[model samples]
Target: MNFTEQALKKPRALLLLGICFLAVVVVLGFFLKNSLISAEDTDVLGDFVVRRSDNATSFFTFVSSIFDPLGTIILSMLAAGIFWLVTRNWRYPGFIFGSVVASAAFTYALKFAFHRSRPPLLDHLVDETDFSFPSGHVTGTSALLFSLAVVLTLRASSRSVRILTWLAAALLVAAVAASRLYLGVHWFTDTAAGALVGTGTVAIMSAILFSQTKQIPAS
Candidate 1:
């Protein structure tokens, strides 16, 4: 197999890569805890987001709400159901469910461990009560959308279709991450770390699931 095939097909390599990503998130949290990045940096960015136009605020608020906890659960289940209907393979849906749960669990654990506070409440455009080292919204959205992208691309016959699937997923993930910053509920590091955690969780889960199965269905 070529290098790309080896990287994608080897469970060990994928798991190791996923672990490396998670490790980076831990190191980033430590830096933030030590004021290495400085709260002033976040505050400056938060101020900029908070002062944006009302229309921008409205647009982001809508975008962020689509991936709230309830929304995430609903969308994830819907995606899983559709995958099962199309492929008739439990592994695809199982991978989706597993990635979402693992990503959410990991994100919450880090939030409590880091005890990072959100931006000032007065600056917040939406209500958020949790510690915000890694944004739960970004984590959940990234996990779900990226997992879907992986599965869709794997089954897609055309290069353009695969590219489009990945591009769409990436854009949605980016929008969700931006929404957190635009809403003044999370620092830039929070969203960045959340994306890492979510993507890593998907990588690890996909490796585990694919290793158990013979091969993903082509159609």
Candidate 2:
């Protein structure tokens, strides 16, 4: 079988892929935490992004707020609920809820473990007191939107629809990541690592939780 067919048919392949992604997250986390990748080096892009913003600060601030901890939880539940209602199946909803919770838990645990500080208070556009090695906003947003994109892709009627679903999900996640940098609340590595954590969580969770399930046919 070809690559796509093998990927679809083999849970072992998915599991291996998921493990690979998560291994990268761990290695990246270790490097950042140990100062092997200096914060000053990683913060350069963040500084530039924050400094370049003029009138767009308000817009990015608003975007960041939408994916805060509480916001992420609410959106995850709403998406899970909608998936259940539409599919009349528990697996999709379960996948959504489980992936998000796993992502949030992983992100926060890394933050606590790393104990890295945020940008200077003077640079921050929003008040934030927590450790900032891995941005919680970007992590949670990526997990939720990326999981939804996968589910939607499975149910998409055409190739174009699947492409659009993935594009939209990616844009949303990137916007949230950029918002964290633009708000001066996180370093570039923080957001990048957050994306890795979030995506890794979803990948592993999907392999374990949904790989055995039959694909939802397109409408």
Candidate 3:
């Protein structure tokens, strides 16, 4: 669509965009909790998680690797590439691309803003050098799965397919989040914020695209 056509759809998209924006702000606020408060929250949660750590176990270590940002991006790109070839439409890939990029940018920005350190109470399964207010793994993986779920729902012809897609997405996100915590690489709150931000990015981007589509008349 042209600029004029896109501009016309903004009204319909505004509400969802606003809601998504608010959700992000709320998540950021959580990260901005007083240093002492945030530290305590992380400490109690981190200690509890570390006490149950299975870092020596290869299972969760493997799971964590599966959802690393690179893995998630590769999978997302492959899925989007297939969709593009089959339907010869850019919308699917475009939306996925935008969602992942936005999630990643925000994740990094927030990490710098909060500068919360990773849990020091336990050994890491893998070495990481980034600030850890929000788990980039969780954010990227959640964006990949959840945004794909949204695309699946849009494409599905049956309610059952849509339901199953969303269920699978939820399970994947949950597993990745748990793996991050279990790996001693992230605090519970970091994963929580990452989930919110990732999901919210998809919500906002998809709503904007939906708005533009709604303005198009049936052929």
Candidate 4:
């Protein structure tokens, strides 16, 4: 392997890095919730969203609707099925399942800990309840897509395929985060924290699994 790849393959280093990132995100998220709930940020963004065309609003509404908790679970199940079929191994499938679960669990835990309220009813395009410092939909979708991308890229043979897969996965995650903002369901910081949490879960899981196998999959 090249020097850069060699450097990045240190499992311990990667694990530490992931933990640090997750901690920073959680702390930052706690602080940002205060500013996000203030009238300045919410009012400005809400006003901008109100002016958008009906079709555009509907599109984001659809995007956020399909990325809810139930939808994320279904996607994870399907991913597990695909992982099993492709690799014919339980190891990667189990990893995917665990990572997805971890993502959801942590997202909710953080939400409860913060107890931050969602955007005002007046600003909401779709009504939602419960704490919303970090968006559950964004977290789960990011975890599922990002983990799938990492797994697929590791299994792929061609450099071009790996690059394309990473790009596609990134775009999907960004779109989901954007939907949360466009639909006025979450603040920008909420989605930001969600992305960090999701990515950190994948990173920690990957480091652990990689340490066991050296390579992610035997195939």
Candidate 5:
């Protein structure tokens, strides 16, 4: 099937892409996050992540630094409240809240299971943590924001509004991932892994929700 052809018309051709992308990400993360990397490659790639950090300076790093776990949590709470007030739908709120909780928990569990260490910091701008692979910031924010994006796009009527919302959501996700890497707290691969995991979680939940959409009565 020509996805591009379908995407131009159907738009939600994202459903199929989401499935394949999630499946591949899950499999890749399973191996990379757990299996022992070669000492040479580990040293090389680890150095590359660090080298990417070394370029950071006064404003670029700070400007690129767009996320904090605490901020995301607070925002999620406020967004949840607004969402509840506007729609009065409980399950969707539950889905958003549940996605964040489940994604965060799953992230930490993977971190502990793999027991990957934080990037070897040359200069610390902020507090450091123990296990660093699959950054909590990236996973948490992406899970919440992307899930909300999916919900909004699904429910929106105006084509322009839906497209704009999705674009903004994608930007937010990218910023969150970038912030983790620029801060030197997470390796590039760690951010990649976190994004993949977060996106995969969103995809899984979307599939479930889409399946159930048929049973829902029109509002």
Candidate 6:
């Protein structure tokens, strides 16, 4: 392994990353909470993103909304389960599972807190009227990818394998986020916020899970 790779493999590196990630999340959340809402920016972002989702009028709505959501959750769960099954490590999947719950909870909390309105340029692919500050799809997809990266980095033996795994995870996250915007379902800002919150959620979850795992002795 190279110097950077070796350094990253250390427990201290992971722990430090967790600490910094959590602190960043706290700061970002505060910024979002206090920043003034801009209708002009919201509309502009919504318009630009909705262009990607111009297929909103197509029959793909069912596939985009239903299949995408189901696929994201199911894929993440399956990946986590596969890891645990092969490695006989339950805590690994546990971490991924915990990330999902936390991401969803925090996403909803921020959604309601912001009370942002949906894009008026286009109708939603699926009915959604409550709040639309941050796109849940983006956040959910981000969490899933982040979880996959963490799992792969933990278990993969080779540098090539780890790099490939992370690349795939990042691509998957981007695709999902793009799909949401391209379907005109979410504003650009919404997806951006989702990505931020989702990433932060994964980091925080990792830290919490590691702390708990530390309390248990290795068998």
Best by TM-score: 1
Say which prediction, candidate 2 or candidate 3, comes out ahead on lDDT: 2
Using lDDT as the measure, the top candidate is: 1
RMSD of each: 2.3, 2.8, 5.3, 2.6, 5.3, 4.5
lDDT of each: 0.82, 0.77, 0.71, 0.76, 0.63, 0.64
So what's the TM-score on candidate 3? 0.80
How well is each residue in 115-206 modelled by candidate 4, as lDDT tens digits? Answer: 87776677677888878768788888888887777667665677888778878878888888888777776877788888888888888887
How do all models score by TM-score?
Answer: 0.91, 0.88, 0.80, 0.88, 0.72, 0.71
Residue 175 lDDT in model 5? 72
Misplaced by over 4 Å in model 2 are: 1-8, 36-43, 46-54, 214-219
Steric collisions counted per model = 0, 0, 0, 0, 0, 4
Q: Please tell me which model should have the higher TM-score, number 4 or number 6.
A: 4
Which clashing pairs does model 1 show?
none
Residue pairs in steric clash, candidate 5?
none
Please give the distance, in angstroms, between residue 34's alpha carbon in candidate 5 and its true position after superposition.
6.5
Clashing pairs in 6: 52-182, 53-182, 53-183, 53-184
Worst 10 residues of 1 by lDDT: 1-10
Q: Write the per-residue lDDT of candidate 6 for residues 6-93, one digit (tens) a residue.
A: 4333545555665565455456556655776467546654664546434544534543564343466776688778877776777677
Model 5, range 86-170, lDDT digits (tens) per residue? Answer: 7787656655766677667777877777677765576345567768767778877787888787666654667787778778877
Predict model 5's lDDT versus the native: 0.63
| Model 3 segments more than 4 A misplaced | 1-33, 37-56, 215-219
Question: How far off is residue 164 in model 1, in Å?
Answer: 1.2
The digit string of per-residue lDDT tens for model 3 on 91-156 reads 778778777887888888877777777876455666888888678888888789877876666545
